[model samples]
Each structure stands twice: as structure tokens, then as C-alpha cells.
Target: MSYKAIYTYAWDLQEAGVPAAVDEFRRLGLDTVTVAGSYHAGKFLRPRGTRGKVYFPEDGTVYFHADPARYGTIQPLANSLLAEGDVLGELTRSDMATNVWLVLLHNTRLGMAHPESVVRNAFGDPYFYNLCPSAPDARAYAVALASDVTERYPVSGISLEAPGWTPYAHGFHHEFALLKSNAWLENLLGLCFCEHCLASAERAGIDARRLKAQIASDIEAYLESGIDYPADMAEAFWRADLAGDFELQSFLDFRCGVVTSLVGEIRDAVRADATVSVIPSVARPTAGAWYEGSDLPALAQTAGIIEACFYEASAERVSADLFDLQRRLRGAGKLRGILRPSYPDLASKTEFLGAVQALRNGGVEEVAFYNWGFLPQDNLAWIGDAMRELG
Candidate 1:
């Protein structure tokens, strides 16, 4: 049977009532409800929210009550709502199969508290929103978080998001910059030169100091020369540039190894009964996942499933993305494609159904919608219709 699910926030279900939300999910022909176990702050406009139309969650807080004893230098803060009730526990007790969606290593709140544990660029400026996976404390915290959730709740599985490095251009609140942005510049600035990363590179026989200096110098030259890299040439730029630089390619490969090992550790830490899947990268097309340290084949071997977010506008683009990802995975693991059924990705129900059809035709046995709160009631209907028609 094809597995169908919708990504949902814990707060949304809490307001809508757990039992009622489960009924809605079942009504939509979904087998599972992947709710947020831990999440970052976001100003979300909820179309089906009962509490309020606009909502902002507590920054970098877990929806479930976390075991304090399982943590170290970095820890997860429980959302204030947990004081009133256990939303996650309530959901697990319901009829729907529950999967905890964890946003790991992307908490700005923890990064701000433990500055030394966050990702630092070549210039030593910290990206406070992203915790460096190479840091021992950060790595321990991620594993502990996953283990804690699975241990506490009778969850079927856990989907790990942002378990590796994040890009520099990720939209943070009120983010403003005077300089022009491109894939080349963002990738250059996103290179982590933190002490942990440098030490890892050294152990791998790389000239860490020289590479750091070279990247810093390259950024300076690019800025001074006012080079305009066309957005369309992102893939071509990386191919040509990395092909010429053996050391740079090795450095990126080592970064992927860091992420892969961290994910493997998390997978081992979780209970054997609970499935451990990973959102390999937030990058579109997923082919540019190397910049965020995600190796698809390596991840497929480490985790149970690779939930590739194929967020494209057309069904053709969605099919093309699945084909590329399948070729890269080389049949190492299961693949689940995630789609955004609302505007900017799909304009009408027809387009949404077409995208779902494309994934099914591409040999995907499982598919998921982006989020419950973000979509209109019409979009929910689209999901139900698509599930019935496809099945």
C-alpha cells in the first residue's frame, strides 16, 4: 500500500483538538500525521487555525516535554503549551500513526545561548541559526533529542530536518543585506571554518589553514571585482569550479562525511522499532545538496528513508527531480517525495494531482504534503481526491 501523510504542527492540532485533527487526517485518506516534535520560530498564517489566524511559535522550542537528564551543554527548551498538556502524547494515542518531525541543528535560540557550538564562516562570523553538527555538544544534543522523543512517545518514526549545515541565504527575520547574492557567493560564505570543522579537515589530510585563507581571499576578490554570477548558471558554476579544484572537492566530500556520520549516529541512537528518515537538504532540485553537506547515497544507507522535498512548480519538474534523485540514490534506500499543494507550486487542484501522479509514476511508494496549517481547505480536498484517485 502507498503511504500518505501530511506535515502538521503540534500547535495546530492542539488548537483544533487532537481527536478532531486525527479525524480530519483520516477523512483526507492519510495513513499518518507527521507532526512537529521540535521546531523553530515562524510567523505562520494558518488558514484552518482555531486559536488565531496568525501565529508565532516560541523560538527553538520542542512541542513535547523533553527529558532534561538526556542533554549536555546544549539543551532543548519545551514549549510553554506543554505545561497545559502533552500534545505529542495525545496524538500518539489517537488512531493516526504518529511520526515526530525534528528540526535539528537549526535552532537560533540554542545557537545564541551556545555561540561556540554554532557554525562559523571563513571570516569567523557565526550563523547563529545553524548549530554546527561537527561540534560534540551539538551532535550529542541532536541524538539525545531524537532518542528522548522516541523513548517518551509511542511514535512510529521520526523525520530529521536540517540535521546538517544550512545555507547563508536562508530567510531569517528582517534579514537585510546590501551586497548582491548568488549561489557562488552564498556557498563561499557558507563554508564553515569553526575549530571543530578545521580539526576534522586536518585529520583528513587537508591543508585547513591554506584552504580557509584561500576562501576568504576569494570572497574578497569577488566582492571587489563586482562579479555577477547568473542564477541560471549555478549548476554549471559548481561543476566547472569544483572540477578544476581537487582540494575543494575533497573538502566538500569530507563535509558530507561529517553529516553522514552524524546522521548514522542519530539513527543508531533511536529505538530499532522507530523508523529514522532524513530531509537531506532544503535546496531545490536536491542536486545542489553538497553545499549543505548532504550525500544522498550515503544518507540512504544511514537512514531508513530519504524524504526529498521535490518543491517544484510543474509536474514535469517534479518527475525530473525524482529521476535525478533515484539515479543518485542507486537503490540504497526508500525515497518519499514531498510536495507543496498550495500556490507558487500548484495553482489549482489539477496541478496538485498531476504532481502526485508524477511521483507515483516515478516509482515512489510514499508521498507527503508540506504542512496542514499553511494550506487552504480546498488544498486539503485536493489531497483527499488525489489519494483516492491514485490509489
Candidate 2:
């Protein structure tokens, strides 16, 4: 079943501006191409290229796009590369399956416009960069957006990334850089205390307010003083000897529930024939996995495919991570390994081939390259070589 694929930014297709890009994929011996459908709002610094704004489109989507009559406001970027070219059509014609990749809950546009739905820190600060999954508007928007892409395009599958909540430590800009590094403290500092989360915790019979106050106080103290607390504070806070808090554990469980529920909704929103795949972060057991609401077991129940990401790591490390994630998700469904064969990880063909072989041995049926645009032209043929060896 060798299902080899490559991920490409929509801008890459726009820049290439030729039907022959399909030929390039054919030469690489790739069977699938996943294109970025609706992405986050940011300024990406392309290689040797001018920076461009990544945003929600006014076209290509059946919903969530600009509609002056229905929304009373039209999004500025009405024309996009997806709507302008026949790239999707061409890829389909070339006998390659196309998947529309969607990023959820990471939109700065909606988060900034509707601050009410943004994630709130324990210190009462709102991170206007991340949309709250528990927010009704944000949930509805994500579902509608996923449905629109599947309904309007000829995509064979729907790939969901960042479908859950984000950490508070993100989007702090230069402030985050200046702070000291402490995994346990960073994890605690990343917790969210938004209104929706708080209300849900209350309904679940958990004292979210008390936990929030304690967290705020501890975090504030840690910031003010260089004194280090217990090394296992993040995980041990629930222990009887430490904080003896069961309600705090319940609060964490509530966050995971929110994420699981969102994945289920997105699965139902897409077309029945298309597969729903999710990408969750890879973290150590010492670091709580449910913090970002990425419960593999629960989410796997709703999703058809689990595209485990093992990016920016060595071949042996990628092998270890892929195997561990495979064990966790294997009982649920198929596994697709995503990798980066370019800088910071591999410098030669031996490393790339070793990684590909490791992925196959680790029970990965499909392997998707990190991206086509980020890697140089010379590095692409390695994909073909690996696929040939595997075949």
C-alpha cells in the first residue's frame, strides 16, 4: 500500500504558476498532494521571496468567506491562489489524490476581532492570537469552514491541524524569549482560564476559580522571584502531599473533553466519503499530553487517520517517536508519518533514507514530507529514491 505524499503551501503552487508542477510530483513518485486550504493569519517569510499575508479567503470556500450581504462585511483578500488557478483541477487530472489541509483555532483574524472568544490566561490576560475552542462562534466557524472546503473542492481527504486549544505561553512575542526555561513551569504557565472553560468546569462540579487563583498566585511568585519550586510541581500538584487537588485534575480532563468533542464535530462536518485525519503535538509522558486537549485515544475514535508528526528530529529520534505514537493510535486506525528531510535534521541522503526506512519499519503505511516549498529542488529526488526502494 505505499501511499507516499507531499505537503505544499498554496503560495508555492501560485509561485510555480504552471501545470508542470504536477509533473514534478509524478517524478518524485508521490501519489498524493495535500494543499493548505484555509491557513492562519500571519506574515510568512518565504525563501528569497517577499513576505505575504496568510489569511481566510473571500473565495474557494462554500462558507466563512466574505459575504457582504450575509455577513455585512467582506474579507479584504477576496482573490487567492486557490481561487485564481486550476491547480486542484490539474492535480486531479494527473491522477494524484488531493487533500485539503485546514488549521483550526489558530486564526488571529477571528481571535482579534472577537476578543470574547480569545484564550484568557490565569492572570486575566487575553491572548488574542488563539481562538478558544469552547467559544460557540469559534466552534461553529471551524465546523462550517471544514464543511465548506470538502463540499466546494474535489478533495479526497480532510487533514486537520491545531484543532484544539493553544498554550498561553505562545504569542507573547519577545517576552517569551527573555523568560527562563523550565518545562514544568512552562506547562503550568500555558494553562487557560477562559470563561467558556470556567463555565464548563463549573458544570462538571469542579472548582475552576480556586484552581485558577492558586495558579495565578504561584506563577506570579515564580516570575517575581528567581526561586525554583518543586521540579514535579506541574504533575505532582494533584498529589495529596503536594496540593491534594482532585478538582484540578478534573479541570484538565474537561479541557481534553472540549478538544475531543471538536474533532468529532469536524469529522461529521466533512463529506462521508472523505477521510478525517488529525495532527497532534508529540510530548513526553512527564509533560501532560492533555494540556493542549490532544487526547489521541479519544480523538482517534472520531478520526479515520492519525497523521503523526515527527518533524525537526534525527532519524533515530523520529523512529522512536513514530513507534510510540503508532502504538497509541494503532488500535484506533491507520498511521501516516510526517517528516522533515531538510535542514537541522538531515544533511545527506543516508539520513533521509534511514528515516524513510525507519518510518516503514515503525508501521507507517503512508509517509508525507514536511513541505515541498521549504526544501530545495535538489532534495526532492530523494523522495523518489526512497519510494522506489520501498516499492
Candidate 3:
């Protein structure tokens, strides 16, 4: 595998274009990059949870957004994706050390055109937001979007931001819900009782109704006790609220299968050696609720890389932990760390460099920084210098 340091995404530069940023990255020591998002790329995360918004993805694994739209479709946003690819390709052509990773935003115009594909919530209410991967239109949209990526620019490959799982099973109005919900900043995600989800469970050999009954009983018990139970119990009660592990795992497996399967299909669409990868949540659900439900065994068969996503500015321990999580995957050593440079978490030059050192020390082969535009130029310059100096 290549031991390259990459920036996760090109942060939106409303004023400065992608070409400028890519040029700067080449000068900065960035040999590889995985563009995080461009223009309302996060549109698909609706019915949002406490984390504000998931960008897009109100639905579960199979569902897609009702509509697909890109952010800032004006001159800058319009040409942003291609511009970045062009610049990234320039770096690659100039020197094999540089590369690009393209991704389809879940909430783009492509997602809007296919709402039925988005996941339906517990109330049979689908978030008018998010893209549903299970819908036929989703495949069509992806094929077209991905084709544009592989065909148009100098993209080395593309990867999607990791999909999150909501373990809390209360109501779509539940506290953890992220997008398309009444609350955008709570820790409450409800149990999904939508017919499609139930049917999916049933198809997985589970009796969905039984699971609902369990959830009801657990909730009643928890309510009668009048205590804040552990997240694990809350989750077990919630999932049992829907069905049994057989069905839950079955649902999880099916959902995870959808993503990995897409990876396979995407592999067919891009360059034969174009790498296909997924960024999954670092940990597993203790209560087996919901989160990035990746099938590592299955993923190992197709994915060329694995990424651990988290906001930048995390503790060094977090950087080490990210490295550890990647290590546990089937490829063991072929793991990369993804860091987002969002607000309230702007990593400093020292902090970013420390993060890189920690991950390298932890045995991570590749480290990616988030959004290029938002980060201070000096930071990238520092990173470039560090990458050249680091072993």
C-alpha cells in the first residue's frame, strides 16, 4: 500500500476556486487527497441529530434523498468538483506522489430526484431529505454522477463519507435525530417502524411485530423505573422494540450490504486499478442499535482502503485510537485516518502535525486532513514540510 498523507476534502472556497486550492496542496506536501464535500454536499443529512446535521441521510442505509442538488450551483460551485479534479490530476501527472478521491454528496440534485429511495422513519414519515440507496433511481443517479467523476477529471478514485447509524429508537422526533426533524441538536434518534424497514427485517427472517412489542415493553419498564438507562440498554430496548438480533443483524447486514455492493459496482465503473473504499464509524454498537454498519469481512473483499472519520482537533489519543480502529479491519494495515477541519475544531499547525505524528506512530499508513479551503494556508504549508521530513 502507499504511505501517503492526504487531505480528506476540499472545504468550500466560495471566493477562491478549486484550482487554486489544489495548486496550493501540491506545493504543500499533500501527495493525495479525498475531497470531503463541495457546496451543500451535506444536504442529505436531514431530520438531523444533536450533531447539527449529517449533511444528508435522513433515511437508513438503503434509502436516498427525495431530491438531488448541489450547493452553490453558481459559477464557483458549478465548476468546483471538476476544477478540483483537474488540479488534483495536474499534481498526479506532474508527480505520481499526488492523487484525488471523488465522492457523490448524498444531498445533491441527484438525490432530490429520488426521494422514495431515502429511508422512511418510525412514523412512516420519510425525511423529505436524504438519498435512499435501495431505490432504483439511486443506482441510476450514482452511475451517472460516478461516471462523471471517473470520466471527466483526473480523479484517481472516489469514496463516500461514512454513513452513521442511529441507535436510539424513540421517535423520528426523538432527541438524537439529525436531519429533516424538529430538532437538529439533540442526542435522541428514534426507532424506525417504517413498513420498508419492518419488511426488510421480515425478509431477513425476523418478525417485526415481535420486535415492536419488545421495545414497547422495555420503554414501559424504563419509563416506570423513571431512570436514564445506559445507552446500551436504551439501544437493546429500542432494537428489541423493532425485532430480534436475528432480524436486527439481518437488517444491518442487508443495509451494510447495500453500501459494499455499491463499492463493487463502483469498482466496475472506474479505472480497473482505481481504488474503492468506505469510511466506517470506528466502533461497534454495544447495544446493537445503529451506526456506520460496515461488513468488514465483505468490505475487505472489495475496498482498496478504509478510513476512520472524525473532526480534526481531536486529542492525540483520538488520533492513536483512529489508527487502532483501522488496524482492526481485515486489511489490518491498509487503514487511513480522516479528519474534518470544521468550526469549533480548527486544528492549529502544531496540533495537525501532532495528529499526523501520532497516527504514524500508531502505524497508520495514510493520514487525511479535512477541507482544504477552511484550513489556514500556513497549516498546509507546515503539513507539506512535515510530510517531506517525516519518515
Pick by lDDT: which candidate is best?
A: 1
* lDDT tens digits by residue: candidate 1, 290-379: 789999999999997999998888888888899999999999899998899988887778878888999999999798898998999988
In candidate 1, the residue pairs with backbone N, CA or C atoms under 3 Å apart (3 or more residues apart, or in different chains) clash, namely: none
Tell me the lDDT of model 1 at 54: 99
Q: For residues 9-91, could you state the per-residue lDDT of candidate 2 as single tens digits?
A: 66677667536667788788888888776665444434433344342233222211432332212122233553576565555
lDDT of each: 0.88, 0.69, 0.48
TM-score of 1: 0.97
For each of the candidates, give the backbone clash count.
0, 0, 69
Off by over 4 Å in 1: 230-238
Worst 10 residues of 2 by lDDT: 67-76
**Which parts of model 2 are misplaced by more than 4 Å?**
41-83, 86-94, 169-177, 228-244, 282-289
Write down the TM-score for model 3. Answer: 0.66
Error of 1 at 281 (Å): 0.9
- What C-alpha RMSD separates each model from the true structure? 1.5, 4.2, 8.1
